[model samples]
Target: MNHWLMKTEPDELGIDDFAHEPQRDFMWDGVRNYQARNFMRSMQPGDHVVLYHSSCKHIGTAGIVKVTRAAYADPEQFNPDSAYYDPKSSATEPRWDAVDLCFVDKFPRIIPLSELKTLSALADCALVRKGNRLSVMPLSANEYKAILATTNR
Candidate 1:
C-alpha cells in the first residue's frame, strides 16, 4: 500500500482525537491547496498515513492512521457557513476532495520535525525541505519505515 503524510493542528484534529474514537472514520477535509487536494485524490483505502501535528507548541509526527475510504467531494466546501466553503464549487463538479482516515497507533512520544530533518531517509522529503507547506504529501517506503522506527515500535 502507498504511504503518505498529512498535517493537522493538534487543536483542530490530531492523534488524540483519532485515538479517542479509533473506530470512527475521520473526514480529512478543508485542504485548499491544489497540490494537497490532488494528493488526497490519489489515496486509496488501506493506504497508511503519518499523522503530523503542526502549528502547535510540539510540532512533529504524532501517530499513524490509515485511509479507510478513498477521496470524495469535501462536504465542507458545500456548506456556506464553513470557513472552507467555496461559492465556485458545485456538487456535480467539486474543486476539493477529502478522504476518510482511521486511527492505527499513537506514538509514545512525538518524533520532532527537527529530528526528522536529520534523517537521511527523509532528507529529500518535502516535509523536511524548507518552504514546503503542502499539507498532504507522498512518503517513500524508506521514509515511512524510518519515521516509525523512531517510535521504537
Candidate 2:
C-alpha cells in the first residue's frame, strides 16, 4: 500500500475527529486542487496517511489514519448546497474524488512543523519543502517511517 499526507484545518475534520469516533470511516473530500484530487484518486485500501493540521495556531503533523476505501466520486461535488459543489461536474462525469479513512493513532502532542523541517529524512518531502502546498501529497516509505518515529521522541 502507498503512503500519503493530507492537510486539514483543525476546525474542519482534524485528527481529533477521528480519535473521537475511531470506528467511523470518514469521507475525505472537498479537495479543489487538481494535484491533490489526483493523489486522492490514487489511494487504495490499507494505505497509511499522515494527518497534518494546518491553518491553525499549532500547525503540525497530528496523527495517522488508514484508508479503508479507495476513491469514489465526491458526493458533495454534485450537491449545490455543499461548499465543495462543482458546477462543471455531473453524475456521469465527476471532477473530484474522495477516499475513506479511519483513525489509526493520535500523537500525545503534535509534531510541530518546525520539528518536521529539521528531519533530514523529510528533506525531500513536499510537506516540508518551501512553498509546496498541495493538500494531498505522496510519501516514501522512509519518509513515512521517519515521521512516525518522531512520536517516540
Candidate 3:
C-alpha cells in the first residue's frame, strides 16, 4: 500500500483527537492546495499514513493512521460557515476532497523535525526540504521505515 505523511495542527486535531473519536477516525478536510487534494484523491483504504503535527510547539510525526475510506467531496467545501468553504465550487463539480483516517498508534514521543533533518536517510524527504510545505506528501517504504526506526530506539 502507498505510504503518506499528512500534517495537522495539534491544537486543531492531533493524534489523540482521532483516538477519542467514536470510530477512532476522522475525515481529513480543509486542504485547499491542489497538490495536497490530489494526494488525498490518490489514497485508498488500507494505505498507511504518518500523522505529523505541524505549526506546533513540537513539530514532528506524532502517530500513525490507516486510511479507512477513499476520497470523497469535502463537506466543508460546501458549507458557507466553514473556513474551508469554496464559493466557486459546486456540488456538481467540487474542488476539494477528503479521506477517512483511523488512528493506528501515537509514537512514544514526537520525532522532532530537527532530528529528522539530521538523519541522512531522511535528507531527501519532502518534509525536510526547505520551503516545502505541502500538508500531504508521499513517502517511500524505506523512508517510512526510517522514521519509525527512530521511535523504536
What is the C-alpha lDDT profile of model 2 across 13-78, one tens digit per residue? 999999999999999888899999888889999999999999998999999999999999999999
What lDDT score is found at residue 49 in candidate 1? Answer: 98
TM-score per prediction, in order, is 0.98, 0.97, 0.96
Report RMSD (Å) for each prediction in the order shown: 1.0, 0.8, 1.1
Rank candidates, lDDT, best first.
1, 2, 3
Task: Give the per-residue lDDT of model 3 (tens digit) for 34-138.
Answer: 999998999999999999999989999898999999999999999999999999999999999999999888899999999989888888888999999899998
The lDDT leader among the candidates is: 1
Error of 3 at 104 (Å): 0.4
Clashes of each: 0, 0, 0
> C-alpha displacement of 2 in model 2, angstroms?
1.0
Clashing pairs in 1: none
lDDT of 2: 0.94
Which consecutive 10 residues in model 3 have the weakest lDDT in total? Answer: 18-27
